[model samples]
Target chain A: MSLLSNSAVEKNMDLAPAPLKKEKVKMKKGLQLFLIALPFLILVFVFSYLPLYGWSYAFFNFRPGIPLSQSEFVGFQWFKSIISNPTQTAEVMRVMKNTLAISALGVITSVLPVTFAIFLTEIKASWYKRIVQVLTTLPNFISWVLVYSVAFAIFSTNNGLLNHVLTDLGIIDTGVNYLASDNHTWLSMCMWNVWKTLGWSAIMYLAAITNIDPELYEAAKVDGAGRFRRIWHITVPGLMSTYFVLLLLQIANFINNGMEQYYVFQNAINKDHIEVLDLYVYNIGMLGTNFSFATAISMLKSIVSVFLLFFANKMSKILRGESII
Target chain B: MAESILIKKKTKKEKENSRSTKGEIVFNFFNMAFFALITFICIFPFYYLFVNTISNNDLSSRGMVIFLPKGIHFTNYLQVLRLEGLGRAAIISLSRTLIGTILTVFGCALLGFIFTQKQMWGRKFWYRFVVITMYFNAGIIPWFIIMMNLKLTNNFLAYILPAVIQPFFVILVKTYIESIPAAIQESAELDGAGTMTVFFKIIMPLSKPILATITVFAAVNQWNSFIDTLFLMTDSKLYTLQFVLYRYMNQLSSLANIIRGSQGGSSISASIANMQTPTSVRMTVSMIIITPIILVYPIFQRFFVKGIIMGAVKG
Candidate 1:
């Protein structure tokens, strides 16, 4: 036992010098990394984390140019106000409905086109596939403002392309006011959203499809399966994982219909169908200068989005044995 | 062995039932129709925009041209170029996108490298900190407040600074960095190279594909962005291309007034006269705004696909 202890001491003494050197090197590396990360840490704290404290402003009647501590805090006052006010409450619900409807339409229209594009890329004609891919994706780069303008050109009552073509062909006696009609507004918004997004969304699925093994297709061919049969059996099953992942991620943003596209397209004529939650927040916060109420709504949105994300992640695990979060 | 025998029997039965003539015909017919329909819907808008841009203003005004050009006219393009704010707005937008993208990519890359180092203390804490920011933000109002407090409201810094270090870009860069092999770092350390030296010399070079992808993504995002300008920029002089185009879209009728005035027509009363809305002009403006970005897209598309696929698979 004494002999073993003497050898252990000798070994410890021999190894101590190298470990000390390693510790010094690690400390140096840590210091350098901290220095490098200092600015980012400061930025995250100031911009992201600090404003989280401002969630407290939802309880207060927040005003600019006043210290937050000095502001009067009335617990749940904004939430109570939102609930008690019938007109405001109706507007909120209306906007929420509009947001969901638009997003649902967008998701439905986008999914098939995206899936088709991914499948189409697997076709034999390489050049044709490339052209189709390029042409399809070109629109994704175009801004919503541009898309709205194109829609305006086509659907304008006075001089729109559709009105002109219909009138020229003697199909209609009068021009159609497509933009002003509330019934058509939501559909128009959905069409525009799908047009801008379908190709971009397809890119993700296309990447997923490319990752699929080519040997599966050969095996299906050897079984004397036709193209459509093979696509149904093989291509779709291959894309299932990616489809689920993207679908879950997208569902997490169910409440966040884009603000800019809606805001730009929205007119008083189409306000009923187009005033989504993001725009509602923008109008109330930026335009109306109702800072506290807007903050309260924003806080509510954050909570809801977080819950949705968690729920979606959990559901993904339940359904697919994988979750993004 | 029993399951394999059953599977083989099932395959033989399926093969005997497959390859029906009616099924092939029906499949071909529907496939062709669906393909044509999808392609038409996707491609028609670009054709519409192109035809409208080149068609004579009068033909467009009369709503004569729909699918094809009545007469090719470059006059609108010339007129757009001659517009007062066009050149300046283009320049402002171009410079802002270029500068903004460069700063954002480098900053995110540097931060990503630092965060990925295993020796860094509290690395997990910082990673969580950044990721949490991705999920929750104080909304645009508080961000605007921060910008105001920093006195960045109207200056170009307002546009650039707020967007310089996006949480998404940082995450993407970190993911890309993590995929790089650790052996390179070990060699650099043996050479007595510091973290910065290793990052700039070894790590960044290996990350060219991702860096290029980030550049394109950031550039396109910055170029297409108008909301930032809407909130931060009060000055018309500082307007980006998209914002300027939006202004024209909102005030489209004013272009007709300018054109009519140039044509020596009777001065139309501002309130009563129904001015031509320049529907084609709006289309032309849209094209003008997006043309630069579209022209540059193919260069980035290659990097974008590779980088995203690699990142997604690795993640």
Candidate 2:
């Protein structure tokens, strides 16, 4: 027993030096990886975080050519102008109304994609389903510029196809300016959005459907449930969690109706109802050249969006017992 | 008892055949028709544009070419392609897509792999630092200001550099790498492979699927982006095809004038010149811009679906 203990003690004494050496080698390797990772970190810092420093421009009357240090410090004066001044207040309110109205329409119509997905799975013919999916999803791949061009070709006053058909049918004496008309601009925009994203968003729900247990369908079938009942009880219940999660995300992004779509579609006539917050910022910043005021508005938007995201996260945690983030 | 059980089974079968089959048939017909209509709506615009651009411009401009081509000619595409600065813009767009995609894929793959290593210094903190950027943006003005301050205005690097470290792609790649069996990496380490060596030799090959996914994403984004060009490129040389198409759409008269100016030297007849209407020019330009997407998107589409599934599952 003493000999065996001595042998074990000797083995430990010999191996005690090895881990320290391995630690040194491991530390060196980590340093090498850190060196390699440093450039990407710097790139992220420059592009992502570095812009946060420019948010300070809101406090200054920043000019294009002049340095911020030389610009006058306004100290929330631009933010004050958004409320304290009547004309500015009206403009902000109008922009907010446009933004909120468009977003609300978006949220309300969000269920259509879910419905589309449910019905899409009901199609028995696989080839037809694939074709529908491929074609419907194609528009999402193209840029908004191309979509606008498509809109133009189909709706232009002089050479629109809709007008050509309508005139041939004697539906009207003249062509309606569908693209430029301010009437139902919100609804039309929503329709255009639905046309673009319905298939793409349905893909998420479809994926979620695949995750549902096939055994549930089997059990429901054994219980003599009808096809519609099975879909209602099994598939829909399975998809609600995904739907609610995506809906929460949509709500979190309530204010960020992206600029590209609205930017390309907006014109002099439709600008009143079509301009959302992001587009408004771009217009004032780039076209109006109100950099300081634009900065202030966008700063507020970013803060509100982040707060909304956290609020949604909290809601998700409280209700679903999961952290979305 | 056996006879009564047999009768009950027959009745249930009859009920299924008599009632459910008819209702399901009707439901299926409408469902198929509805989807067929949607498919047609989705496909018809591209067909309309193609027909218009290829048709005789006089008839097309008069709204005569609705469902089909009237006088087939490719002159609008020819003339639009011959426009000044278009060839350069195409080259610029192509180069940006290639280089930017490669850079982004490499950056994402490397960062993702390193982040999975337990030995990575401050791996959790660094990963969070990168991933958190996905949630909040500093807004457009500040971003534009920073780009200008960095001298990215009128510079091509403006497109390539800012896109390299997309936090969303990084997270996607990190999740994917985590799913790869760590035993393989450990085996590579046992073979005396260094970090860079192991990454190049083993991890990259194993990661082709996810990397392919990100490649499609990065390439599509690079090809479709025009807002960046609109903001940063005051220089005409750096304009992408999409942005140039946008310019033509907004300024149809000037575009028509330019086409006429370009075609004056050709011995074409007055009728041919008349065929190059502003509307035709715009439609042709739009077609040209979308052709690549139309051709490539279907081939790489499954990768995108895969990416969406990955994101959904991880979330």
TM-scores for the candidates: 0.86, 0.95
Q: Give the poorly placed runs of model 2, Cα more than 4 Å off.
A: A1-17, B1-9, B267-274
Q: Evaluated on chain B only, what are the TM-scores of all the candidate structures, in order?
A: 0.82, 0.94
- What is the per-residue lDDT of model 2 for residues B251-300, given as tens digits with 9 covering 90 to 100? 87788778877777865443653457778878888888888888988888
Question: Residue A271's C-alpha lDDT in candidate 1?
Answer: 87
lDDT of 2 by residue, A1-325 (tens): 4554555556556657789798898899888888899999999999899999888999999877798889999899999999899999999999999999999999999999899999999998988888898899998888999999999999877788888888889997888889988999889889999988989999999888878999999999989899889999999999999999998998899999989999999999999999899999999998898999999999999999999999999999999999888
DockQ of each: 0.31, 0.54
Native-contact recovery for every candidate? 0.41, 0.73
In candidate 1, residue A276 scores what lDDT? 84
Candidate lDDT values, in order: 0.75, 0.89
How many residue pairs clash in model 1?
0
Q: Candidate 1, B13: how far from true, in Å?
A: 15
lDDT of 1 by residue, A209-297 (tens): 77789999899988877777887888788888877777787788888876888878878788888888888888888788787888888
